[model samples]
Target: MIPLAGWLLAGGSLASDPAPTQSDFGGAGLWQTPTARMAEEGELSFTANRTRPYSRYNVTMQPLPWLEGSFRYIAVTNRPYGQPSLSGDQSYKDKSIDLKLRLREESRYLPEIAVGGRDLGGTGHFGSEYFVASKRFGPVDASLGLAWGYMGNRGDISNPFSIFGSRFDRRPGRDELPDTGGEFNSATYFRGAPAFFGGISYRLPSRPLVFKLEYEGNDYRSEPHDNDQAQRFPVNLGVVYRIRPHLDLSVALERGNTAMFGLTLHTNVARRSEPAKVLDPPPAVRESAAGRGADTAQVDWEAVSRALEDNAGIRVSRISRRDAELFVTGEQTRYFYPAKGVGRAARIVGNEVGGDIDWFTWVSTREALPVAETSVELSRFDALLAHDIDLDEFRRGVERNPPLPRREHVLYRADPPRFSGGWSLGYSQNIGGPDAFILYQVSAGYQAEYRFRPDLWWSGALNANLLNNYDKFRYTAPSRLPRVRTLVREYLTDSRITMPQFQLTASRRLGTDWYGLAYAGMLESMYGGVGAEVLYRPFGERWAVGADLNWVRQRGFGQDFSFRDYEVATGHVTGYFDTRYRGINVAVSAGRYLAGDWGATFDVSRVFANGARMGAYATFTNVSSRDFGEGSFDKGIYLSIPFDLLQPRSTVNRARFVWAPLIRDGGARLSKRYTLYTLTEDRDGDLFHDNLDRIAD
Candidate 1:
């Protein structure tokens, strides 16, 4: 009469605790499983149970939170009559499923620090656990764990008539080899000892009940009965019992060599259920009778900026018919967390605009500027020009701008018109330069994406700009334009102006199986900067990976200086409204610098998915004149498929060429910019589809 397959059920506060008559229950118990939260949002659950012989089921799902998908099932109910029935039906059934996720862990309010990818289902397929980092020094509350699993099934005890006398490893042996190979083998196979264990658990603060102490054991394979390796050890003693207010109850006692006892019953299920006469009422009298019967609330700041640009994407910067007098200019930067000798640079400006010839739509913004808040004073080697027009063929390309027709007689090889210019700037060496400082500026922008739902995806932009500074006059050798330096002569008469700026940006994509995303915004110089970032990709493989970081802050007007430990501010006019407090003049140099700038970039023909293609890359940049310098270093190694110039097709003399051997400086010489030969003779030459006639020729 051992038909006690109770499949777990032990509700909380069991008679106010203390009443262990039924032999203290047996190890690892706390059943009453059925967890939930929020109801919808990709739900899933299952439960099944049968009788005779066997039949059980359990299933759960979420899809993301680092992913978790569980499964369990068992079946067996007949056969078993002769000498352990070799293959003549003696009962067989067992199937399992476990696919847990979370490649990284270290966030219990940051316990010393941790980083991504934890057990990508390596050892023993499933049964992964990790907790580490613990503290409660006073009354104990310890923690430290790392357990792996694969003991898969050890159940079932039912049949008709036995031969009496057999218990192998459970200890009763005395057959000395009989019953045809000890009852037809089969003590459950695959015991391949895939071990690795480390454990620690503590808790003792009793008041109504609390006392836990655990110890784990492991050592895979050393033979204990076929299938290889077996060394066990387990210890646990528990008693917890808060009992109410969301309930909880525990009961544990385990000690290797087959001793076990358990019972648990925790409950919360997204708590909330206690307001049946607990002082309720008064939300200003339920909103004063629905605001005196509705209607009378007006403040539609453009429908709250189009409901924050369609439910929290916030992108605002409309006004650009090429240049409707720059009403949107932005610059807000900050990243202070490095201060010893000093070295940090930031300058981001992204834009997007829409309407006309809808190359798929727009509205964008991105601003990040603050290298001492330059008001022009730039020159390291500069030259610029960039453009993009598709406002529906932008007035038919400005009514056929440029000697009518020349853009390949009506540019439109499936929607053309995108441009860009050349000549970047750099140079800043007080000691062989390259210690970071290459600000070559010049831009023109517009980008777009507007979808309310389609699994929800969004992006927008707009940009307008110009700049040409040869980095403080490259090498200052031929210097004569008011030049004088005793330690930086009033920033050399500040003269770096070509100001006409603007920017905007937006993004969104949230939940379905393990989804998440949210972002905030703002950008409009001297005091207009805001930022946010988040990402989670539950399950998508080919060695999938995830993690992201973002931050921003700013203030500008210019007149602050302090070099010895860094501190610059000399442009003050603060009191909040139209505030001002300038940039740069902070110097207190130390050690820890890994300045970066490794040239060499070549990409010829593509084919390297596994080997060979003629590719070359090397770009490492570390900046630190003071703050823990080693803050940057990008590794590189590349080689694409070229299999010794793979034979394809070539025909130049008759207007058909596919030459690709582009290399950047290894023997010097890489210049070919005759205004991109009038944008590859106007169109379809596919040099990126004449990107807006090479930025408006």
Candidate 2:
């Protein structure tokens, strides 16, 4: 039997085992070494640590139960970015990507096993690969691992894989790679002499603390840039305190003399929460008079439409009836969770139409285009509405469908709102290759859209710099291909107040599963373009296909109406797939790019339970790696965070961040403001199907 003494409640229930906390280097580990333990899936952690020569900022994500990923930036205070003349006195900055995969789960008799790589696709400053196993016994959790490369610099053990080939005994040093970084360095992975590392973490009984002691494998004698330190002993000691519900503080003594401190701010994206919606009006449920079947003309649908919009968050454009079915079609305005709005619409219609209606169908639209249809049987729903049946049981009678043709009778029609916009703070970061030449800008941005019809609108945005460090932007664009995206530096420092976008957009529902979008204006900061897209997404399907075409001219340094001489016709035909399991979404696009290059781009992302999306993408074209310059190709990671997750009220706004290892001009696409796939996100996907159980929430 497993010992209960070591198991303690973390962010989960008391029955759940104590989960691993963030390591100083930004993953789940003990002191400076990693363990086989993995954080709970869908958790995001931000960690900052300071030791001696290095300070690190890391963002780690658990996109899957058995997978972990992290992106970190390490600042080497003792090292300059480059020659002092070019980089000034700024410290050196190195970015790294890491990934871990679980091979086996911990059982009563077996320890958990995991294999991972650090600094996999970046500069090999901290490169290493390892295999680890961990187990728990009473109050102590023990781990042992073998590592290669930087972490295994001690090299006490022989190369076990060398027997197979001579190449297995050789590991390349960092000096062999390009200084611009961004390479996978797969040839040297696990090829060096290995070393053993082990550690044990003790959870204090009834206390929110974990005491850790570890034997590190890295001797620090072969540090990059010759910044080596003396290692009197391989042992390190540390302790982590749960200072707050969402905060972790760790202090450690490492390398026999150095003092280390780190803090991690983390949350489970799978279980995000905000203040309750107690202040918002509840779902309105009008009762039938004297339990009698009523007439259709007696219902004031205009009032019902207003109620649906006000309380249910559904903007009613029209209401119809066919036999005992009442159809209410409108755009979803407020709720990101379709189930919540559908539930409220059902209650409002069910109560207003009385016993005469047997089914309620709410068709949700994007712009004027129908996307998803939710039909709820009144009899089964009444039980749920009354709390007699739980949500799961009530969902049995629920049906999700595509938008159907107009019903028999029209009851109400109202136009959607004519204006929508907001003012928000925006931040952008620019990278002029690697080696710490980064610049950031903060701006006050205002965007508004004026609608002429439900399917047509004109939108524009103006940004004024609030705070920035543009004076430090001194790097020049490096591109052998057409200068499609390399003009970022000029755009960043051109003008403080600029209008990046002012566009007219229109969309149409071509067929039951077809959507078309067209827009023209200043498309993005780097380019001015006109583009159109069409998407074919079947109802209740996991796959979709789309094609887009655009003609674009580069925008001027002033970001105004003036255009540049460079122009190109670029487009792509893309296929999108959603692996409904584990919230993974994949898309592949192939066609001509902005720089007149032909290639394919592959994008993969994970959607957390709270609507946050974390994704990575890569592009490879006909251009050779040497011509494409450092990083070999184009690759980046992006995170889209919904604003509602941190607000007191609900919102459809999001904060998007994209970090490319190095910026280049190959395989670039026009950055359009809206795409058909994004506008019709609620259609025939996981949004409604996976959330059917929340109909009464």
Best by lDDT: 2
Summarize candidate 2's per-residue lDDT along 1-697 as a digit string, tens digits: 0011011112322114445777778889997778998887767777879888988877787878899888878888898887666578878887788999999999999999999999988888899999999999999999999999988999988899899999899787777766656778888889889999989999899988999999999999998889998887999998999776567789999999899899877766666554466556776663644553378778888888998888888888889999899998888777767887888887787776666789998887887788888888988888876778987788787888888676378888896678888898876766433324457788999999899998899999999999987777666657788887777778888999999898999999999899999989999888887889999999878899999999989889999999989999999999999987788999999999998989999999998766778788999899877677766778877777665555556556676767676678887788888888887888745657666665776
TM-score of each: 0.19, 0.93
What's the distance in Å from true for residue 351, model 2? Answer: 3.1
Model 1 agreement with the true structure over 245-343: per-residue lDDT tens digits: 223344544433333223222221111111122221111111112222221122223332332223222232221212211111111111101110011
The ten-residue window of minimal lDDT in model 2 covers 1-10
Clashing pairs in 2: none
Error of 2 at 678 (Å): 1.8
After superposition, which runs of candidate 2 have C-alpha atoms over 4 Å from their true positions?
Answer: 1-18, 178-180, 285-293, 430-439
Task: Give the range of the ten consecutive residues with the poorest summed lDDT in model 1.
Answer: 340-349
Separately for all candidates shown, the number of backbone clashes (residues 3 or more apart, or on different chains) is 73, 0
lDDT, candidate 1, residue 13? 18
